[model samples]
Target chain A: MVEYKDGADFLSPDPIETQVLQGSQDSEGVELMVKKNNDRLTGWVSYTLSRSMVLINGLYEEQKVNGGVPYPSNFDRPHSFNLVANYRISRRLSFSSNIVYSTGRPVTLPVAAYYAEGRPFLLYSARNAYRIPDYFRIDLSVNLEGNLKFKKVAHSFWMLNVYNLTGRSNAYSVFYEVEDGAINGYQLSVFARPIITLSWNFKFGNYNSN
Target chain B: MNIQHTYKYTVTKLFPGGVRPKMHLWVVLIIALAVNSCIEPYFADIGDEPELISIEGSIIKGLSRQEIVISRTTSLGNPVFEPVKGCLVSVMDELNNEFVFDETYNGIYTLEIDQSSLVEGRNYKMVVVTPGGAHYESEYEILESSVPVDSVYYDIEPSLDPVNGIEADGLQFYVDLLAPDTVSRYFRWKITETYEYTSAGPIHYYYMDLSFEPVVPDDIWGLYRCWKTDELEDIFLTSTLNLATNEKKQIPLNYVSTLNDRLKIRYSLLVHQYALDEEAYNYFMQNKIATEGSGGLYTRQPQQPITNIYNVDDASERVLGYFWTSEMTSRRIFVSKLPELDVKDYFYPLEIFNMEDHGAGPFPMAIMEEDGVRITGSPICFDCTRRGGTTERPDFWE
Candidate 1:
């Protein structure tokens, strides 16, 4: 199925703190998925290819972003692949795993520098012309169920989850800042390390009978 | 028990903490998720942008010297423009006649052609040979006859400038054109304005000798008054195809603020009209839209306007600019002061000054006066030549 969406946002740069920029985003994409359910190994794989662009022409020509060209939207990732699998090891234990891969998000980068009015300024490439590194992550989790008993008032299951099993530092964003009359680029990753979580899911009133 | 009551009780029992309190946590999580969205800088490898040749010129009938400019586009970061020099340029008609152009300035070429040789309704084209041995030519353009302007006049009207907002007193200039009898015509106009202005102060008396004793009155040589002329840069195009009548009335050319110095004294405007073919008209119309449509919420996609000129050797090589032949008609009008229009009180008051020959040198000092007293300031103020215009009158000046 084909889909179309429109969105708007308010952006403010540091120099013009009071100046709020109004930008519009347009996105169109298609998705496809294949699933094998009710089998020994239940799994589903999906892929999506899409393009999104943002036009921030601003109220005046001077405030135009990306020289008024429609740049790639922040969420625009042309290609994405996702695989989710769940396999039952036994009646009491089950395993689930997920793998995700997608093209990196768009970012505006500086291509060159110049001096104007005795101050150094960076000339940026077209808005969103470059992207962060491609993103890939894998997650795994195991579910352990308690033994069934007719007299028990409640039964519980424990889940052990490992987020970002490989601890890959997928870049959340790449940023540039002017320092010492020069522009410097840096990458920032929100989830830079693996995380583990343990949780108990409970059912009341002899729910195991079903 | 009622189903609604049962559901409500179950929800309350499921969350010992009231639903409202638990919902607050969910709201916070959502807000955090939204705030966590980030923006970063990235380097895009767009590769090398091709530098293409840019040619700008026109072939007008009856012109002694036709001028053309050739330059190359630069990369995004560099603001400097590179002009193409030492190129062979020529204009040729279908009758095998050729007019060659000589490079006068950087990237600028000029040709002196016989005005009698330019015939109306004859097809003409421009050819250029680059220093790198590339040949370029434009499509043949027929010189169309132009209609004379019926009148050029100005009216005081209230108007709004998109950039500066409502201007209550504006002098709007308009052109009236007589309709062609049979064929539909496209019209393009160019406006040139010349205005007289004076410097701050007119030097009335000066010391003829270096000695402090001799002061002589200077003769009135019209040194205070000068004139400056400039051509308008905006593109203006109108066509009679959509109008019911062949005659177009009061087509607006430009507007001047009542407070503007151009209207303070005497102003003259020269309006040139050209008749264009359908293709040339379309090209100019698109050019007008592209330039005038900027600084607004709606903007046309940034693309080069298709030019008639193309590379003769390599069809893939992109060329910029248009070459077309058109018959042109011109009209001039002079405007004096209008007492009927109400304008804001604005004036540059002159200051009186005294000069002394101190043994070291001669120095001028400002002489203060009462608030209502009017006195001329220094020569820099009243001298017209300081403003970059000559005291000599133009041949066509009325």
Candidate 2:
């Protein structure tokens, strides 16, 4: 069965306030998911094997100005994938893990540079001028809960493992600072922050059956 | 039973040859479709941008002129405005009569036309010569307007409102309709006044008229504020009517009695009917009045000008007519002359033309403070008049 579904914020302009479109035909791929059976062994897979682009107002050989085009704001990427799964090992314990992979984001890099108004505003090259490297990450977590004896008490434990598998760096922006004369790329990245946490809680409740 | 040998040979060829040919054809078709397709799912890499073309022009018809600005589109198919310079933007009639646009300042240009040049049925077009040698043009028709004002007059009586103190209430000009009537008509007015500075020796004369009406009273009064630093000029006294009305109105020129005192007031009104967008009309009006008081007179010439509407007027221009009024200090009786002459400017010389006589006072005038310039007795003399114009200086007396 094919069905059209509107997300909770389908009509909103900026759902995440990120000032970026979630998907577009000439820019990036969007994905949907299916759930089978129960929460157990439930996993999602999404891949953006496509691209999106912005045809800027004045970013062409015939439209260069000191103050670049009207923000062509490029959002392009291909081959994005996300997989997550949860498995119940016993009546009291469950484990979950998730994996994400996506192609690099597009960015504009200036070629030749000039000073204007004594500030650094870019005269961007064409549109999606450059691409950052790909990104990948995996995370896992486990939870345990049980009822205790004639006292009518329950206990729960949660353990989370962030960046459980591979360690990687995701690039966000790259620019050059003119000191002396040499032009070099100054890379900025979101490094993997590997972490783990454990929490325990006790509760008292009536285990009533009807 | 005898056909066994023949069947074996046929089966062999059918199994391999027929299936293989079909499979090969399908593979080749799929490959061609993919190769010819220009629709890539991936975005193409864009390159650097190049310089854009700039187009500059203006709208000029009758007493109205507005700057026309637009830019060219990019490869991304979007329009972008440019920092334009050195262009001959002008308007020409079919008679080959043209006004070369002077780049008075930035993208702004000017072309003045008198009422005569604006015929009821003549056509006008604006042409622009770009810095890069490109020409662009747009045309419009001239629209003539009927007289907006039936009449203007002053209140025969003084103000009774004591809040304003003893003073002249003012003159009011009433139109035939409510202001900004559905049918828009542009109008203007001017006022001329002469005041004696000191001992009736030097008469400081002032003259101003609205380029179009209803006039912005604040802008007009602002000029007075600049000239006389001590007191705030009362702008509310001057008003404009956008529509038509039969009611008579007044324009008050409150008198200021000083050690160097003499006063006279005069004003005129002009109106035109023209089709204009709200912004364009507002801009034209604002620039006209604001530019006038600040500095720079718009005159006829191709040289440097303050605004584009200079020299646009001509003789025999049938516009809303002008009005004039005058006041002389000589014709008045005072309180001291009550028995013998009782003439107005004679005794309490200041009270003759004041609004209180007409019952318009607690003058509706603003409260001003003393600058330690003491007033001992009958002659309320201050070292410095609060309105900033002072009698202390010899030059002020003249």
Query: Tens digits of per-residue lDDT for model 2 on A82-149?
Result: 88888888756778888888776765444332221111112334344466556777887787755434
For each candidate in turn, the TM-score is 0.65, 0.33
Query: How does residue A44 of candidate 2 score in lDDT?
Result: 64
Worst 10 residues of 1 chain B by lDDT: B295-304
The numbered model that scores best in DockQ is: 1
Which one is best on lDDT? 1
* Residue A53 lDDT (model 2): 45
Every model's DockQ, to 2 decimals? 0.07, 0.01
DockQ-derived CAPRI band for the predicted complex in model 1: incorrect
For model 1, the superposed segments whose C-alpha errors exceed 4 Å read A1-43, A48-80, A85-210, B1-44, B161-166, B182-184, B203-223, B296-298, B344-392
Best by TM-score: 1
Estimate, for each residue in B1-398, the C-alpha lDDT of model 1 and write its tens digit.
Answer: 99877766776776676676457556656556533534444444546755667677778875567888887755434534467899999988999799889999988899877778788889999999999998999999988877777899988887766666756687899999896655447889988988876654444444333453433334444575778888887677888887777788889998887655777777899999888887787767655654455433222222234478999988877666678788778899998877876644335455443333223333332222346443444445556676668887788777
